[model samples]
Target: MSAHRSLSWLFTLGLLATLPVAFAGGIRGTGDLGLVIERTTGSVRILETSGNRFLARVEGLGDLSHASVVYSRDQRYAYVFGRDGGLTRVDMLEARVDRRVVQAGNSIGGAISQDGSLVAVSNYEPGGVRVFDAATLEPVADLPATFGDGRRSKVVGLVDAPGNRFVFSLWEAGEIRVADLSDRANIVVTRYEGIGVNPYDALVTPDGRYYIAGLFGEPGLAVLDLWHPGEGVRRILSDYGPGDEPLPVYKMPHLEGWAVAGGRAFVPAVGAHELLVVDLESWDPVARIPLQGQPVFAIARPDGRHVWVNFALPDNDRVQVIDTESLAVVSELEPGPGVLHMEFEPRGEEVWLSVRDENRVLVYDTDSLAVLTELEAATPSGIFFTARAHRTGL
Candidate 1:
């Protein structure tokens, strides 16, 4: 071969050698990644989801008592919302914090815009929502939950809806508001007042058509037809509880824990040992399956066949599986003490759960209901996977 030809061949060989490095920066698939939040230590552990291997730990996050995470569309960055209002953008590939900001005094959770350009946080201290640039973590807009003689209310259940909108509920105001971010510089607010008494948490349907808020001070829930906003909000199941006598509430049921399966919704009844099955079509209560204890998180498996539920306080050590088709408890597993949270694999093959008291993360096969692997962690609370990037209203 001529010298020029030989040099060209050498360059081609070098390029092929570096191809693996390029792919390493991007997640190869959902099987290769996930995050475990250590609530007490204010840190996160990146893991290889398939093998249950610990990859890296990113720390120094502040007051993570009630933290949550959302990933960018590319699944390369994780936006973590902390209890102390700390929003830390973490680079999943490099296993480090790319950017960090303390936007408020206290924050509950957050959501990312449809186009992945904005990150919006729901706050409690100053009682407001703040939108920031997803790339830079810079302030984009500040929306305060002010009402009734200018008094602020704690904002909860903040979610990003289509058409550049961020929807949330005000706990004290008993209202729901939609902030249009089409013009991110100045948000146009649409308020739907008198939603219910003490709206604790809310969630948007998978199709982004309906937004429901669970009332803490009442037995029923408030629903809003997002596609038809002119109809306003209406109360559903207004008399769902045992009459007159107040029900005992161990912990406030989180709306985020509510699950949807096969055209129906399995919601944990507030302060009750039952899962209320609601028909998504008519918005009526269909059935209530009695559970072991007050449900904390009742999440549906990806295939919509089974729902795994964990309880609050004294019953947190156990997790039970419910069959969606028959509407009955199918299986039960003891996950040890402080079973804080659970997340299934993207396709529903396996699940990863955080057992805080045991200082371990347990991985179980969904079909067998058997523990496959366990990785040591410290006070782990939430388990998030990059696969959430492709889902709506995550």
Candidate 2:
């Protein structure tokens, strides 16, 4: 098979949401664009591709420093999961906040369903998965963080499983959960033990065939078949790094900065100053992408050609762009300060970088690899982009 087709077919199988959504159909392609999910401003900014300039801003969010943007299957809605446990409903077309529900002390982050019918939130501190209505931005009734057992569970990763079903990770329990979002009124599911200690994130491949979870506490991995969610949830610990010393697991893995795409998972190994690229087929490490400093937040280009990574260390002032194919650091672009999260404008080549310490959003030219514009934010910590999510136009 050809290389690009090999990647595309792998995705035909995988993976949405809410609030009076009039948008239609799945995305054809993001076009020449990048989307920035701004946390501090509580706004998603639109940077036009004509240049790295703010074209328009999606408004009406509040103190969203720890939120994430996961688009609907059709790109009609953008689900904003906040660190403070605020779930905001946003209209992708109108570029406005439709509604929001706040969960106290909850840092909501996880995977959305492919059909955009359900959303799963991993409450790290409290240790549970909160199911929600994808469109109306409301909560769905389900088994409320309960197991017939006495042991309290700690959930870190909640994923969209097959046929609009849901699976969650119990970090403290070292187990995987299969729940029914399709029947949210009275959800029924089972839990199976896996290889790792604190499972941080889980994602289904584009083709909707396989699902994998990354372990944050131990050097372990879990792979499962989507159809038989209960079975095949096996944990593999073969490819663990050298000098693999056991760390304290008082709490679950602390958001080790992870994301998945193009049949690969990019997980930040802060202690090692490297990113683990896990292949889906064998469910193993195909390559280790190294960086100069401690990598924190990471993002992949829409084309799947490159991945942008940031280090939490003070010395790493710039974001390093890596060629995904070669697993090599291609270039480092400047936005300055301790850069953390990133968002791509919907209509441009620019990726918005959140320089928290600098309190600004730097728009860099993707082609020239130069800073084109910088929008000073009010205590800028996170950045996002929201625009008229055009179907035909984009």
Candidate 3:
């Protein structure tokens, strides 16, 4: 054989053999995640955040794919929710498809369960929430966030509570629904409505005795006693020398995400672009963590030294890291656009955020807020960390 032909053939053979074995560890087919690209109408990109470098790209899933995603408690798999309600499971380990299981009721942009067993999805267009099983991906249950008083109730957020109950936020009715998830068919629970017209989110305290409702409408906090369930839920920060005009169902001013630590709860107000620090013992707005943009999610590090907040819009390009003690914006890492949601690894060292508009996932060093690298997706929408989400032979 000629020398030039021999070298070319050898290189081609090596490339063929290396390609299959390189990503062989990542599982594919039924158990992997589906990177849904809504805008491109092409293949969806899969990101391997678990690895050092953001290795990527997958074909065939196409656009109009998954919307929201949920990771199993064991970190065994991830479920992607389509905009039109198509739900599929992605095996994280192998980084491939598992199979389709269920579809949602409407166009939901968010989904998460309290126990990580059942998925609660927010239906944007239809204005409701759908609940489903975490494993089987079947139509286990469905419900709305409406109140008996006849109002357009939209599901904003839903968190799993103890005693097989779910505390849901009603965007329009301005109430909180604690439904009995034990019986999916005929679930029943008491509804608590007070404080404001639209409670953006409801949070159960660690003691499980009382809960905090983010009064987005009026821009304050509401305290509900679990023992009473209703009994006229008390309005906290009612007279902190009020200044602004109070109204029914005012967003942006709404407080979302609950960080309960050091005998207090930290609520993020997206409208004011600040963290409404509330003391559980006193139930008052102690102080405000002035962030750069409208903050949506706030999660504390393991040492409690810092808490990271994701800005939703108007300033969706930054992830502000605040010092827990000073409660000041220590550093801001520019992670591109649409940095709405983020989650930490089990170690609390790695932060994974989805730049939905940019179609990329930015992984940052928790301490320095420095960009380690980024995982690019076709239209990378939702992301999650798998601490224990394992996978076998695909």
| Per-candidate clash tally | 0, 34, 23
> Who is ahead in lDDT, 1 or 3?
1
Candidate 1, residues 198-266: lDDT per residue as tens digits?
998888888887888888887888888889988999888787863466557778777763388888878
lDDT of 1: 0.87
TM-score of each: 0.92, 0.74, 0.74
User: Over the stretch 242-343, how does candidate 2's per-residue lDDT look in tens digits?
Assistant: 246542222222232225557776766625666778776667677777777666666666566677887765544778888777889999865677576665
The lDDT per prediction is 0.87, 0.61, 0.59
Q: Write the per-residue lDDT of candidate 3 for residues 48-113, one digit (tens) a residue.
A: 444644434433332344354556765556666566655566655444556664344455444445
Better of 2 and 3 by lDDT: 2
lDDT of 3 at 18: 52
Sort the candidates on lDDT, descending order. 1, 2, 3
Could you tell me which 10 consecutive residues in candidate 1 have the lowest summed lDDT?
18-27
Q: Tell me model 3's lDDT, rounded to 2 decimals.
A: 0.59
**Number of the predicted model whose lDDT against the real structure is largest:** 1
Best-to-worst order by TM-score is: 1, 2, 3
Cα RMSD of all models vs. native, in order, equals 4.3, 11.6, 6.6
Which should have the higher TM-score, number 1 or number 3?
1
